[model samples]
Target: MFSPDALIASAKRTISLEQDAISSLLARIDDSFVRACELILNCKGRVVVVGMGKSGHIAHKIAATLASTGTPAFFVHPAEASHGDMGMITADDVVLALSNSGTTNEIVTLLPLIKRLGLTLISMTGNPDSTLANAAQVNLDTQVSKEACPLNLAPTSSTTVTLVLGDALAIALLEARGFTPEDFAFSHPGGALGRRLLLKVEHVMHSGDELPAVTRDASLRATLLEMTQKGLGMTLILAPDRTLAGIFTDGDLRRALDKGIDVREANIAELMTHGGKTARPEMLAAEALKIMEDHKISSLPVVNENNQAIGALNMHDLLRAGVM
Candidate 1:
């Protein structure tokens, strides 16, 4: 009953059919697409996407994509709109309704109310001649010759085409609005991209008494104590003026041991890297990570313009802060 070859053959056929359906959508991206974009761009209120069943799932995704990419949007189930939920929509909103048949009764019921409010309607339907398309100000034809389903009934290729078209619309508006990565990060502050863009070195670096430091005249044993107390595996060697004179790391301790130098007696200045690579207080934690990576070092001193050591951080600090 478990025939691998038959399963592979069926999967390939389904993929090929879906590929063909998606390719056909390219020719349909014409003036109607531009009008749809223009209508949404000019709208004063948010985009309200509505659909039913499988189409409702795709409508929800499209709304999320539009909202995160600079356009304000949300999804409202068509069936719910018939109830008191219709009040959620306003005269300023633009309605984007999706239905492959363009005749889903729940959606059709809202058309009258949408028209009464004089709201702009955009439709995504397989049948452009259907009632829903005829009522729309602009119709995005998502017609597919056949479904990936062998029975040609389940929505497969058509939903993919609609989703891709929605992504195209969102990205076009994002570009038109000159949306930046910072703008996107603001929308996704809890995500990794937000951590990379919004997290500053000062936000994660150790400062004040937490900063591990010792004078250049200190012994290697004293530096080791400072490193252990700070738990950064390194310490800053400062000059008399509290300016950064050098940095000493675990690697330097290893090299000192190789040279048969006694940690209790050897001057830290002899083993510390003089005026080593540094970061700024306002620098991005991601940028600080880059600097550590480029120099192949694990620790960095946060210095001011006058070369005064203000703070310090290590790879673990970045890792703890989610910058790594």
Candidate 2:
């Protein structure tokens, strides 16, 4: 078996090489990269990323980065392209070709069809003078000083350079397109970021009959009953027209008791907070959580312009809705 120290040293060598490779990637972010960004940003259709072998893996990642960052893109294997996948490319699309040697037979084989389609070509290659690079309207040089492989055969450093270059392009276009967190959330609705941005208080608030409520004239006993029945630890006080008048919480009940007010004699108005903290229905749940925190309150009453209790929501509701 290989000694553990040797393994660790070899791993360090790979990491160091890749680190240098990424650092060297900064120079590639020149006019060629800018032109590539302009092409994808102006493209009416998707970006088609094509590569062969190890370059294909990097190309796939590049495509995913592009798609998530606002430049719509997908990866296509050059081998598969020659095997009838070439039909997927069209004049409306921009083709990003990847070849470390700039001479992958599979990618070279499809150059004529790509040109015939009149598709904009962007190539990433080690040799800018090679056929693939020569064909491109823009060429990104992913050439590395050396491979990290002990035998200089594996694609460690080169792939890192290519991946970093792709990231640069993605971020440049992302900023150029003004892609915001909201836009990213729209693309990933099932993810946590989406839940935080897209989930509104109305989506999870308990409304109508489910809302725990009382009235300004209601007795303390009635308010307690409302809170107990609703199991929300609080009750909303509403007006005759069902508009929110105030809120009575367990804290208010405690305060009322401390003041020696009899629950039977006290009305909801005497023990409730008038026009307390409230939230709008369309407000983001994350924003609601901030309101709750700012107020140091556990529950919130979502109200309309009439001050009507349209909804009752608690911190637990946010947790359940994945908004917390």
Candidate 3:
């Protein structure tokens, strides 16, 4: 077989160089990183990210991660800042300026005004001596010895180090702010995580007259009729005070038939299972699903504190709600 050798060898070299770049990035996370974290954590306004070209793309991504993980941020292109986008940067906001060489003119072009406004600046730079780095309140060193590009010319390793440094800052601030999954859900209400976490039992559970309910003194035939009519696969046995007394399900019917009990004559109170698994109106639908799973049942009656049936839900309701 003829070997197309140079391209394959070059590919391997790119992978190795990038791996080295990432490894070098780890060693660079030191006290300066702590200063960056402190500045972001203390900021009362949004984190405004600014960069040019390839760094601009990375800056946009960093801004999105910061916003999603509970730190409010937005991306402003450095070139656009000179054309009046500079108004987006408020004095209370922290400006994250990114430049691998730390002297990108597009970013530096906005410096005089950004400084005049007295806004806090945080810079990611390979060159500590560069103007942008020297002007910032915090400097994150994203220096890499070489790039994955074989020519060592492109922004490969530098971009990776910058991205890692951005992630490090985001996660540190996220932990310090005590950002929870529920808080993230509130910000992303249209996604699956929001649907799963924020959608409550009351929003999905069957309420009012749709609930399959019967009194304990009712006949087994009447309970079975109620179950068949309501199609919940079960029926709630309620006390006189409207609290749950017991439950009658298809399982109880099968057992009663196995024991030769006459459904027409049997009292539902004697046939029903007393004090079975129940759900509350305020309980999470996901939690109710877990209880049903643990008990090997398919339905649960939601009840009040006095044990009266307030509502009922089944596995089908959960499946329809997309909680399953």
- Candidate whose lDDT is highest: 1
Residue pair clashes in candidate 2:
244-307
Model 3, range 108-176, lDDT digits (tens) per residue? 888899889998999999998899999988788888888887688999888988898888888988899
TM-score of each: 0.94, 0.94, 0.91
Regions more than 4 Å wrong, model 2: 1-4, 258-261
Q: Which stretches of candidate 3 lie over 4 Å from their true place?
A: 1-12
What Cα-based lDDT does every candidate model obtain?
Answer: 0.94, 0.90, 0.87
Q: Ranking by TM-score, best first?
A: 2, 1, 3
lDDT of 3 at 190: 85
Q: Locate the minimum summed-lDDT window of 10 residues in model 2.
A: 25-34
Give me the displacement of residue 43 in model 1, in angstroms: 2.2
Q: Clashing pairs in model 3?
A: 242-308, 243-307, 243-308, 244-307, 244-308
Q: What TM-score does candidate 1 reach?
A: 0.94
Error of 2 at 26 (Å): 1.7
- lDDT value for model 3: 0.87
Ten-residue region with minimum lDDT total, candidate 1: 262-271
- Candidate 1 or 3, higher TM-score? 1
